[model samples]
Target: MKLLFLLKEGFAGFRRARLAVTIALATITLSLALLGLFGLVAQNLSDSFQRVFYQIRLEVFVDPSLSESDFQTLKSEIERIEAVQSAEYISPGAALQEFEKDFGKDLVAVLESNPLPPSFRVLLKTGHSRPEAIQAVVRRIEALKAVDEVVYPENLIRLLDKYFLLGILIAVGLGTAIFAISTLLIFNTIRLAIHSRQRVIEIMRLVGATDAFIKAPFIFEGILQGLIGGLLAAGLLWLAGDLVRYLFLPGLSVPWLYLAGLVAVGVLLGCIGSYLSVGKYLNA
Candidate 1:
């Protein structure tokens, strides 16, 4: 029952069943690594969606022939809309300049004259990026005099929004399922490992061994397995993140803090698995 004796027993058990312990740890590492990658991607995608949502604009191009007073009136009307964030007017020349910047100077030179129209780029408030909401605002703008076109890339935005939502749901569901299965696998592995030494456990139980005395070594062994698994999973995830970033997104490597957080989560899962499995057998 002493701490030193318990530690020695745990170490002896680990030494006696190194193969099974190693296998369980390796399986936990692989499974946790997959889960961590899924978590990282879901978090990043949600963040990207938020940033894009804030940046989306509902453009209202105006008739270039409108007088200064008419333009001012139109701008005022747009500003009064509930979902309007801010509005900026782009003159025909400015529109042409923006196009030139995108296409190149030679392309701009080929144009006989600037064909781009003056427009008002309207940034929307949060939650106003939905198609129906944008359409309502667009309709209101179109009804005003001297407005030529109202553009918001409605179809593209809707598709992106839908896909983002779908991706997030799928990722979350898959991650959860994988984690559950991994926990069971690791738990059973430890249970079987302990079961292989039933003679030792039964002997201890018969010779005035308290339940805690018998369970201590197994619990310690579980903790050791969990720590090793968490570390391996964390390392693999970090490496995979680098490979993915290099292959696809040049500046997109996993953040160190996020990786560390994932490892911590893995450790928790491992402990929970081990505790449950060992506890059940101990009770039995």
Candidate 2:
């Protein structure tokens, strides 16, 4: 069986059964699209978790009445803690200015004096953002002499570190289920194509057609359907990504390699599904 003949026969299969081919392609596109969506969300969730894990910082406010030397000593002690990565002193004036910049209002104009205490902007090492970890660190910091308060995003980190981890597990389970369902759908769709052309397949087999010769066209048919489905799914995903970027997260981006991988997976699922269905006839 020449490549050209296989190509011709594979395409002819479509002309013989347009509706079946269309159904197979539609299933492939939908399955691959859903798989791609699940993958995209999982990646974003992981990225957000990592950003919070390494970027979190705690604000350690000291008594504003402390001498400049005492403030320096406080920072030195904080930097020496087991979990502390670094601590930088933020003067009362600097803290006030930063608050003004964030709030877009001048406290000096509203109140006669800056109320912000001089503090240390403290960064923690990795694996220290969990609620328990942060609590221990806070207790230690507050115990230090002259420290007023240890401020951080306690609620936000708790939700992200604890709850988001649970969410990732659920996402993984859901993704696995979706992949199974999609594979089953493709298998069923390819089986239908085989059943519809059972007579033609039997006739070719009787005429001394080698199983490979008979299967070539069907294999190519599956690949063709998968390729078409992949293209359609990719197009839809790209459009959706664009809409999401414009509507909510202006910085959101889908990696190009991941998009390419989705297409490759589509083609792979097509070939696998086709092979499984076509194998049944070879045994018969």
* lDDT values for all models: 0.77, 0.86
lDDT of candidate 2 at residue 91, scale 0 to 100: 90
Badly placed stretches (over 4 Å) of model 2 are: 53-55, 63-76, 88-102, 112-115, 159-165
TM-score of each candidate? 0.78, 0.82
Clash counts for all predictions: 0, 0
Worst 10 residues of 2 by lDDT: 47-56
Clashes of 1: 0
Residue pairs of candidate 1 with colliding backbone atoms: none
User: Per-residue CA lDDT of candidate 2, range 1-284, in tens?
Assistant: 48899899999999998888888889889988998898887787678767776566999888888887888888889988999999999998898889888989989888988878888999999877778988998999999999988889888887787676688789889999999998898888988987788888889889998989888889899988888888898888889999998999886778888888888888788888888788897788
Q: Against the true structure, whose TM-score is highest?
A: 2
Query: For candidate 1, which ten residues in a row score worst on lDDT?
Result: 269-278
Using alpha carbons, what is the TM-score of model 2?
Answer: 0.82
